[model samples]
Target: MDTRYITSAAKPEQLPDFDLPELAFIGRSNTGKSSLLNALLGRRSLARHGRTPGQTQMINFFSVNDKVVLADLPGYGYNVARRDVAKHWQPMVDTYVRRPNITAFLCLHDCRRNFQELDERLMFMLGRQLPIILVLTKTDKATRNEIRKQKEKLKKRMDELGIDYQVIIETSATKNQGIAELKALVLDPHLQVEDENS
Candidate 1:
């Protein structure tokens, strides 16, 4: 259960050589990505939580039990007014996800808000290549009925897009919900074996 930050890369060339299997976490800014990582690792500060949008601008990597890597990719769809700054993230993220040794992708979305067009586009792009685990974060902020509605809406959109049914998890970092399920997915033996064979 040991965890430690490895490095933060701003570009593809700056990324460390991939040796262990990696499960990358990505989402829009302030989608509880950092909090979820901390909850999963049982650490209070593995990934820094910030109030500011686009606080995590680098591709941060962490080693878990020295067996696998967890990459905290920079959040997208932030600072829409600064199109130039936000534009660079697409290429960087695209390159990192395409890298070798990536086992799966965890795409987090805030349950309090409706899924945006950008989210759909990103999911569509990533879904085409990797096994995507759609995580609905901040569920504690919404009521049971609201959460159910949000899940249904997202599923319908995915179905329309021909995205096969994937594991969709509802999580609340404050409530410690879905943490175990997420950990199970990340540490699944099949994924580890896939990395070993690759």
Candidate 2:
């Protein structure tokens, strides 16, 4: 699929005025969001993976085949101080998520570790508001048994939290695992922006 960078929005007004359905990618710092995005799009360095945690401070937008908009949200819960997250990041993220044009959210999680309090908080926030897909990233770092156990554990946590997510996708960006499934999900023709009432 064709993809191109649109623009980065540090404030609400700076966001690109696109009418296309949007998918927002979000997760904690170092969750391999960039790597996964690149893998999904079949392009290397399309999302620019950073070595330092929380390197992405702005919301980066990319157009996918000119049919869908992919919003690369700034990764939270990184090396940032508590005050910085509260004073800046939280409000910015809150504003973006409230927009009606967002079709769904791709929430990434690392397979090597259990979901933390921050991840749960995000799940609770987006639970009933919009469709969510809990993407387990870096699956190649763990064994097949370990991946299965992690998926099962995550399913239990989601069940306990009552998060009605669409699915849990396991992906290894380097090894090209589950990339096709995610890409198809993003490019599904049936997905459309939801209105406030519907």
Candidate 3:
């Protein structure tokens, strides 16, 4: 569980040279991307959590055990982003996603809220390009019934939209729920992509 900070890139050209398999964590603001990263890497604060929405504005990379690279992308869909970040967010993300080393995308979604249009649009765009696993974050805050209903609704909506996802994982960084399973998926060399029918 040795994780070290690498670099933060505000532009595509600034990205470091890394041959390691990379997993990008992306989601809407306040979806707990940093917290889940810390939990998954077994480090209390390796990835800094933003106290305010839209505070993370760059692509931050980290080396986990000298094995894989964890890329922390800034959260989207926040109205309060700094003007510069807002201007550059789209292109930076666009380039990063197309990088040859990206192994998978871990799309975090807050379990307490219903899906938004941005969620659908982002998933639709990414679905055809790379394997995406929808991570239902902050599950500890919701009741079991609430989580179940939300999952059902999300699946139904994805089906209707024809948005394909590799898997859906319920995670609670605070409670450490499903962290091990998620870690296994990320580190597994032969990460399997399950069809929508399965």
> For residues 1-198, what per-residue lDDT tens digits would candidate 2 score against the true structure?
898988898876776777898889999888899989998887788788777788667899888889999999998887356576556777778888887888888899999899888889898788778758888899889998888887888889988998878777788999998787778767973443232111
Question: For candidate 3, lDDT tens digit of each residue in 32-135?
Answer: 98889999988888889788788767899988778888899999989323676677888888888888888888899999988888889888888878757899
**Can you rank all candidates by lDDT, best first?**
3, 2, 1
46 in model 2: Cα distance from truth in Å?
A: 1.8
Cα deviation of 37, candidate 3, in Å: 0.7
User: Candidate 3, which ten residues in sequence have the lowest lDDT sum?
Assistant: 189-198
- Write out the backbone clash pairs for model 3: none
Which is the better candidate, 1 or 2, if ranked by lDDT?
A: 2
How many steric overlaps are in each model, in order?
Answer: 0, 0, 0
lDDT of 2: 0.82
Error of 1 at 55 (Å): 2.8
| Number of residue pairs clashing in candidate 3, backbone atoms closer than 3 angstroms, sequence gap of 3 or more or interchain | 0
lDDT of 1 at 179: 85
